[model samples]
Target: MRTLHWFRNDLRLQDNPALLAACQQGEVLPVFILDTDEPVRSALGGASRAWLHQSLTALDASLNNNLVMLKGSAQTLIPDLCARYQIEAVTWNRGYEPWTIQRDSGLKAALKANGLSVTSYNGALLFEPWDTVKKDGYPYRVYTPFYKHCMANLATRTPGVLNTARIQMVPHGEQAGLESLALRPKVAWDEAMLMDWTPGEQGAQGRLQHFLATGMGDYREGRDFPAKRSVSGLSAHLHFGEISPHQILASVRAESPADDNQTHFIKELVWREFSYNLLYHFPTLQEKNLQAKFDHFPWETDETFLKAWQTGQTGYPIVDAGMRELRQTGSMHNRVRMIVASFLIKNLKLHWHHGERWFWDCLVDADLASNSASWQWCAGSGADAAPYFRIFNPITQGQRFDPDGAYTRRYVPELKRMPSKYLYEPWACPVEISRAAGVVIGKDYPAPIVEVKASREAALAAFSEMKRRAES
Candidate 1:
């Protein structure tokens, strides 16, 4: 019997469930499609596209002689490939986005009509979003209990790791040759992006090793600091499913088992699972607020203000630095993400959707679950969101998270010469210090677009009105 392993987000040969199953079941042809209609590629920015190319290259190397690259949607391409190759079954790890659901469902129907067997597995997330549920059989909206449930009852299933030496079932593979398939990215690959990130399965494994050996123990303390390479720089890999959560969990369980850091790291992964579950259950959370009361609150649609925020000229050093980092590297520190998101949604009263879309385009690891939930969380319109009145003080946030302002210095080079106090709010520096930094307030780096004290008051009043109406 012939089998096809259709690769999607899951890009690894090691610990890959679908690939392992395909190997075990029969002769296997491994394939990936450069679908122009794929949401990831269609919206992928410079960094993401570059990373995708590298990851595909790595996957091809790992598979040795067994992989093929294809173009066209799997819905259209796979059935034809299956028919042409005389394949009996097509299998893959599932995808989660709303758009992906429509794509996969159509592919399943098409393959079935072509008289081929179609099977899929949950390998993308540690816990498939739908499987985790409250005791009452409903999905949990708040994160803590949801996290607790996930942590308390995470499945012990091991990821399918390939021992290529044990390959007794190598395929007499049939594929539309690479030239005919036309599977290259449309975006020009950015060499700078490649410098900042390592892509693919081996890269993911190396990152996890570094994190466990040096960073994982201090991850809680160091993850908040963008200046330090404290957090595992594996988000892009995880986003693309190069490393499964199960592999991460199993490795942690095997090595550190019962250590507080392992426990903490596991919970963070669970939080990611919870975010997925929240997205799965509340599919409209991307476009509509999870908290319906937020629906009544008005938001500004000011393009000028948004353009400043996007370009990192918002005049708030921390927010600007975070945005600048994103512009340069296609990723931002997690803490700063909250600070800037809150600055836009609450301080400036801009619609969360605008910032969300920009991040969607900019971040290499831009996850639908995390990005969507995080924006709404800051906006106080999502599950377990910050309270409406709990607006971030950009100056205080800069002082707290980036106490020495090293991260600020890296991205906002204009502030590198200023003192630590001035670094957090460089505009507060004397004219002489600003001059020393070669920054002329409004010219070099723009002055604060909105005064923090005034903006805080304005946001508080808006939120207060929202609460009053809700209470009434």
Candidate 2:
């Protein structure tokens, strides 16, 4: 019996339901098809492209270098491979994104019509997006009830074990090797990401173990502080399906009782689930406002401001630091992600999609659901979104989270010499103090792009006007 396992988001061998099911039947041939044709399936951002190349390389190495890689639309490539390999059954993990769900559904129908068996399993998320819903059977718009429903309803399953010794490897037949994908950036822009991240199952497992050993202790208190280095940093791994959320949950449960810190970490995972729910319910989330009133809210676009924000020259230390960290490491602290996102959407009053697009291109952990939902949350145009008036004041956010300036200084080297007192609000320092710090505002460090108080008020007024117009 020959079975084909199609690898999509779920990249790892162990604990992968689809892969394990395929292995159970007979000889397992693992195949990965790069689908980039559909309109909803946009081109991979530069950072994600780079990470994918490394991840695929690592995955092939793990598969004893027998993993078959193909390029083109999965609709054509999948049937072609099945015919070429004389495969009888095909199995794969489900991708919950709207585009993926549609694509996979059509492929499964086509494959089954040809007398080949097709099976799809939940490999990425703890529960399928369609499984959880409100009492009336409508999808959840708010996260609280959705998370509570999931917790009470969804039972945790033990991670699956893979017996690689019993597995038979199919020979790679006319497959495009990892290098043929050209996922790496043409220019040398990823030196720091290369140093900071390891992209496969080994790297993912190592990161999880290290976080459990060291960072988990202070995760609750220090997670909000960018300088603490207490975050699990498992986001990219999660996004790439190098590791499953179940594995992380099981590891935490096995380590100790669910303490406050452990519970908080679990909440964060649930947040990811909530984002998927939003994406599943709202297919046009990435392109339009979830809250329809935001459609009428006037948003100004300044290319100069957008460029400054993108390049980490926003003149606000914390915002710049977060952006620079994103540029350097292909990741940013969660707290800083919120702060910078708020600065962009509220302070600049540009559309949230602009910020969403930039993060999609930059962050290694960028997922269609999470990125879109998060930007909407920050902009107050999402389901269960923050109130539009709750604009984040970057300086206060910095002083609160990045106090002692360690995180800011580490990323924004220009502010390395400033005093801790004047770290966040560098413009407030005396001329003599600025001179002593060897930094001149508006020259070495640019002044604030927009005044915080004024921007907040302007954002509030705009939101109010939009609300009024909607009511009328």
Clashes of each: 1, 0
Instruction: Give the Å error, residue 342, model 1.
Output: 0.8
Candidate 1's residue-wise lDDT over 1-472, tens digit each?
A: 7888898889887877887888787788788886767665235555565677778878877777567777766677777777777889889998777777888888888788878888998887877777788878899988888887776777666667687766533354455545454333455445664676778898999888988888877776788877776777778899888899888888877766476667677777887887888888888767889998887776777888888999999899999999988877878888889899889988899989888888887878878887788888888899998987888898999888888888998898887888886887777789987797787888888988888889888888887777777667
Predictions: Cα RMSD each:
2.6, 1.2
**Which candidate has the highest TM-score of all?**
2
Task: State the lDDT at 294 in candidate 1.
Answer: 82
Worst lDDT run of 10 residues, candidate 1, spans 176-185
Model 2: per-residue Cα lDDT at residue 364: 90
TM-scores of all candidate predictions against the true structure: 0.92, 0.98
- What C-alpha lDDT do the candidate models reach, one value each? 0.80, 0.89
